[model samples]
Target: MTVMRRTGWFTKSIAAAGLLLMAGQASAALWSITYPRPLSENDLRSEYPVALLTLALEKTGVKYSLLPSDRILLQGKALRQLKENREVNVVWSMTDAQREKDLLPIRIPIAKGLIGWRVFLTTKDQLKYFKAVSSTDQLMKMTPVQGEEWPDTKILQANGFNVYTVPEYPQAFSILQSGRARLFPRSVIEVLNELESDDLPADIVLEPKLALHYPTAMYFFVNKGNATLARLIETGLERALEDGSFDALFRSTYQETLDKLDLENRTVFELDNPSLPPATPVNTPDYWLRPTRQE
Candidate 1:
């Protein structure tokens, strides 16, 4: 009886060890990635990326671990880290010629080209001024604000707009509030939430008349040499897109913001993005989101 009991106990121990080994191997397969910027109290900024990354990896059976929110680094520092092939493995950004040359871009617009449409955030007092403006040339006469290193700043300048740039994100709001910059361009997906945020200045209002359009699109980028990782992301994204998973994720994430924008009522002022790379697949209509045409 004692010998039988020992044999049973030994079998159970071996099974448990095998299960532990499998679990460890599974965990080891997950490639860790992170957002380049620190996560704020606002969940909107991080949620979209997390959802897309998760689904993309799952589609390809490529396991990944997104680092905790606290592990993020500033954009410039993150870019540097990617260049050096250090801790940070992946990032997402608006594409430009220089960035395409330096980083391996996944080339798929994660936001379905929606990131290219911008809405202005202006002080309540300045609202009346924009209400009278009817064209891009007229709008350019007024000062617009952007992040100091943002590709949008260069694009705006190339389009003949005088843009005020600040080093920090919050400073852009302060500058707008101070009337130092009359227009602060924000992604249409982001502007509504910014207005509702308790931390945002109460005096700023979304400009009602115009929506700025450009040729730019945001893409997932990695170290130029990390082609294997880039291929993994690209294949996953393509499969997700074909399976309707990508569209589902995008709509589920931004439906509220799209409904709120009432895009049909606003005039779109299309602008050129000179920095857009030759490799951008602009012909892919399936990858873009379009506003409903008004009757």
Candidate 2:
């Protein structure tokens, strides 16, 4: 009876040791995730998104090593790499029909819908022109410029605005300097940071009192078959939302942005995005930031 008891105890000890080893291995399996590298040293707009991604991963208790791609690839190239699962595993962009078809979206708006809230970057010469604009019709009279491949160009065109397709991104600002394009509509977060950079020509300024608003989501997308990571990030984001950490992070990062733009008092010109995926959670009242617009 004593030997039988000793054998049972040894078996239990061995099982416990194996369980510990498995747990240790699980903890050590680091998820090496790659994101797009910054285009320039002054490109600080990625700070909040990267920080938010870090916060979500921390909430999941998953050992992750978030790193940028080795090369500075454009948004289009980086997205292609993500689709191929080659250099990048993740990317954040506005959800449209084509993108939704190619990648698996986490379906959570990383920017809380601020991705669609646009504020114009104008030149001093166009200041008086915008100041008199009281409605979307009046605003559409001026030529608006956007990236050739950006969904905003289509949205603007569909809404009856004569939009110019910029040949290259860097030249978009120069277009404003040359007085060819009157407005370059940028997201509220993006415009603020770009204005802070010394690279912007002195003639550029933020247009006040008028904002172009739309309902859209910027979602993190992975390879179509990479459902595991999609689930992991979505789960982490949901957990953060449940505990209010997500709200905390957004408010802390963007409170100043709202204050600077004076969004509450601006007259909003709401537009429809024809390319938005039908699966977007635009109807989920709790999933977005519905700011109180003056219009």
Candidate 3:
């Protein structure tokens, strides 16, 4: 009887230990992060919030893998894969209504607001044409390259402006430099960096007056189904913010880049006129626009 009782106790203990081991293995955190490609080494090394995010994840002892998609649009595919629980777990800075349906947005901002500066640049001959327009309404009559997905695009289009949507920043700059477009609307800091580079024409000058300003918050997105991982990332991000690690990372990576562009002296509010009514509120929840369902 004593032998039988001891055997029963040992069997139960073994089963319990096995269950605990399986649970621990299942709960082990592993994440995959997908980012947009054509990524330069400089981008990885110096870009502010993203670099900070990468560093913070590493510090947290979480196991993660990064996959770079060759084009911006392919990021959507990666996001969808995350939604389907296909091993992908995270994506950086994506903005599409369809993507929000399945992915949980980490409410914390990964970067500062999306700052856009609207300016009219012209050759010495056509300078007078832009000088006469005192307000955005008058400025809209001229040809401008509207950067796609930029919130400012809607504001311009609503005011009866003929906005030519371009695929990327380089193309928009090309249009402006080649005289295919008269005015180029872009992030002032980003454009200033390009202008200072060897690629831009020396004759072209950016106008002093900004036409519009847009301040938008950027976010990190995680798959809703992966609730445990999402919670861990969110908590980790908030901890980073509170501990000042994020600020340190931002200064180290982005400040030098800004200095090279001659933009270190500029404040975020100055680049994107903060007084503008359309600027998104800081820390607001992600506003996902839903698609209409067909009957």
Candidate 4:
């Protein structure tokens, strides 16, 4: 929603100011942490994550510069660049076995596990059909749409789901609106943001009854050899957690969305994520969003 748009600039401004405060100090270890470019000139989804990264650096009291790539870099390309130590040195993405091995992951999920909780986006007419689904077998009866190369596709397929895929992620929205697909499972964190667009069909709405859950650990990854920078970020994040600033930032950024979803009251269909790396700190209760009524 425009909520992040309004508050995000101020957060960014604070981060920018924090960066200015670090100018001219300890030039030897001084490093430039480049992130992926914005999806568009106005894309602001990265605001919270960026702010958290800045807060981590601020906590370290280190002289570092945060810059975006000169050109656009999608998730795969960004991760590749980070692995190659090219244009970007940092990227925040959901962790898998290969990614954790190729780069250093901070282990703390940047979204506090909100990225794993998913809900369906479907046309108005599909409400009754979805609401009637109380079991995984019933849910899998209808195929849902996902991005072509997304890891979620493999996860869903492994769970016996026949997921329809689109080459371009945005095409899933069109597929739903045109009745070409019955459902499009989207991260609960992203559903509200995607709905704010004025161009989407009015009939498309969230299917609230049946929700999907998995272990989605989004971490800030740097090259495996960049141990110093990795420690800097991890230290900052752990400090933020200890002092409550990390939860504060997370709640401020996502509580509104979570409250609207009322996830605790819904029937959560838990799914397995074989892609999650062995190093993921799933045992750390404090690092996840554990709703009281999860099923």
Best-fitting candidate, scored by lDDT: 2
Q: TM-score for all predictions?
A: 0.86, 0.88, 0.61, 0.84
What digit string (tens of lDDT, one per residue) describes model 4 on residues 110-134?
8888778898889898777876789
RMSD of each: 11.7, 9.5, 12.5, 8.9
Lowest summed-lDDT stretch of 10 residues in model 4?
Answer: 1-10
Model 4 regions lying over 4 Å from their true place: 1-29, 199-203
Candidate 2's TM-score: 0.88
lDDT of residue 108 for candidate 4: 81
Query: What is the TM-score of candidate 1?
Result: 0.86
Give the lDDT of residue 51 in candidate 3: 70
TM-score, structure 4 vs. true: 0.84
> Which is the winner by TM-score between candidate 3 and candidate 4?
4
State the weakest 10-residue window (summed lDDT) of model 2. 1-10
Question: Is candidate 1 or 2 superior in TM-score?
Answer: 2
Could you give candidate 3's per-residue lDDT for residues 1-295 as a string of tens digits? 0001125788989855754564465348566665555334433312544575676665556677766544543334555566775544566542333444556766555655433333455555456677566665567577777666554566566556687777555566667666667777544334555556565567667665444444444566667776555555665665676687876765554455444433322221122322333323343433221111223
Clashes of 1: 0
Q: What is the C-alpha lDDT of each candidate?
A: 0.79, 0.82, 0.53, 0.80
lDDT of 3 at 285: 33
